[model samples]
Target chain A: MDSMMMGAMSKDMMSMPGMEMMDMSIMQACMDACSACEQACTVCSTQMMSCAPACMNCADMCNTMMRAMMRMQGMTPAAMMAMLDACIAMCQVAMDECMEHADHSEVCKMCAQACQACMDACMSMKNTMMSMS
Target chain B: MDSMMMGAMSKDMMSMPGMEMMDMSIMQACMDACSACEQACTVCSTQMMSCAPACMNCADMCNTMMRAMMRMQGMTPAAMMAMLDACIAMCQVAMDECMEHADHSEVCKMCAQACQACMDACMSMKNTMMSMS
Candidate 1:
């Protein structure tokens, strides 16, 4: 997200219930990770491996997770938590699937790394929310 | 999806554990709905209303739901069910938000309609899964 949009989004989040303690830096990192993971997975999904489906699924999940963070005004805390969990689960599944082909495909390796990063970011967001609450 | 890609995806879905009973026509309609909903929401989000956030969130969810259907091989029945439920919830929220200003904005009216159509399609998919199972 651009600085101006992020500023606007941050302003919006302040009025949402249970989002007062959100760290913009943490959310920014997570959104960046999600964007990268989505890009990598979209590329990997064209590889025609059995992992392609998992890659496609993860790309969608990461995009959704990222957008949800940007649109916090539409979500409650519980809804955000559920979305983060779903994104984490998707990243885990995609990473495991991509790793199976990492030895043969460089794209798979990169995709797996992206998924791992996204998973970590989502976990951080979840933990941050828990601590703040 | 183009017919060529759809044909290939259909072939793949046949091998997934619980997707054999899927009706491709229903899947295609749902995909079309999702695609339309996503596009409409994307446009509607730029209107700077309180509904913008919900529209953004719905756009992401619809895109994810569409991709998940195209990549059924990545999903277990339980996971697919959960995703369908999430998509439905997102659509409901978005449609309600959009409808709030439907009388004033033509874009909101179209967006709400798209959301409603997407919800109906997703519900049909869920019902199909239940009946087949």
Candidate 2:
């Protein structure tokens, strides 16, 4: 998301209890990571490898996690934490599955990297939430 | 998804410990509904209504829920149930929010209907899962 969208999200998030501490910089990085991960996973899924199912699952979770950040008004902190955990778990699974064939396929290698980035971003979000709370 | 893709998903799902009872027809309908809902919500979000955030959230959840069904190998029944519940909740929130301005906007009206349809499809999936379990 761009700065303008983040600005809008900031306003929306301010209304939610305990969401005031949400750092837009961290969220921006997280959203960007999620978006990139989703794209990589989407492309990797089309390859029809054994890891395709995991890639597809990770793509969807990353997209959902990104949008959830954009729509903070619709989420409770508990729900947000649950979703971040889900995203992190999905990214991990996708990364592991993708890494199995990474040496044979450059796309799988790129996907694994993207999944790692997303997992790291999500964990950052989780840590931020915990520290803020 | 095409029948071939569904067939592949069906085969993958059969390998899951307790997913043998999953019905392809219901899953197909639910995936269609999720896709439609995502499209409608994407359009609705651009309108910048107070409900835009909810619409975006619903769209993401629907997409995630759809892909989750396609990737049953990546999920436990418990995770699937949690995602379904989350999708249903997001859809309800979006539908309720969109209905408030439905009379003023045709897109919102259509989005609301799509959300309702997606919610119903998800519920049908839930019912099937419960019965099979």
Candidate 3:
């Protein structure tokens, strides 16, 4: 997330064959949202709510999605779209589960919001991919 | 990766609406592979190989992919495919980076192998999805 890291990532992304068309800003936002959501979900999962499993799962998905964006050279457009869909699906599930505990726990509420934001970011990425396609 | 956790995950994966179409055994194997690869990549990244950045990225992606499978209710088939594609992309990047150091570091060699195995498992899952489709 630091400038140096972003510089490294940006340089890498720019060099990818098809990714020359990508909007780095959008990708950066998505990765940032995912990192925040993963942190929130990880903390929320340890709270032992019924939502724990879903939160745990969401944490993992967000982290994976973030890393995938960072390593775009390995992907095709189809693959990127598939990943976005999956990340959105996982966030939706986690958000629904966490919302159930929102009134009882502040962490659950915060985590659910993070999941929602991550879902939105991923949706944006998906739309970007579609437009590019 | 304990039995209790596996039981928790298996029970959740089994109850999803259309996920009964999913093969939990194969899914389980993939998750286990991701977890192992993440651990290996994490340790390898801290070793400061030129491959460090890629290893760090792979570590994050494998963790996310593992967690996503643990939360299947969040996903549709399309989403699952996308996630697998992203994961495969990330793993390929990590494997290629680590392969450069394979002769100098046993850990890199092992991590590369794990990435290869994970890629194979993911490809198998993709093939299964295609067959199911």
lDDT of 1 by residue, B10-112 (tens): 8888777777888888888899999999999999999998799889998888888888887777765655666777777888888888999999999999999
**Quality class of the docking in candidate 1, CAPRI style:** acceptable
In order, the interface RMSDs are 1.8, 2.5, 3.9
lDDT (tens digit, per residue) of candidate 2 on B3-117: 8888877887777888777787998999999999999999999998988888888888887888788777766556666677777777888898899999999999999999999
lDDT of 3 by residue, A1-133 (tens): 7768887889877777767777877888899999999999899988988887777777777877787687665455665776677778778878888898899999989999999999999898887777775
Cα error, candidate 2, residue B98 (Å): 1.9
Model 1 chain A lDDT-worst window of ten: A74-83
Model 2 DockQ vs. reference: 0.32
Cα distance off (Å), candidate 2, residue B15:
5.8
Give the candidate order by descending TM-score: 1, 2, 3
Number of the candidate with higher lDDT, 1 or 2: 1
* Chain B TM, per prediction: 0.95, 0.95, 0.91
Models 1 onward score TM values of 0.80, 0.72, 0.68
Q: What docking grade applies to model 3?
A: acceptable
Pairwise TM-score winner, candidates 1 and 3 = 1
What does candidate 2's lDDT look like per residue over A3-102, in tens digits? Answer: 9878876787766778777787998999999999999999999998988988888888888888788778766566677678778778888898899999
Where in model 1 is the C-alpha error above 4 Å? A1-12, A127-133, B1-12, B130-133
What DockQ class does candidate 2 belong to? acceptable
* Every candidate's lDDT: 0.86, 0.85, 0.80
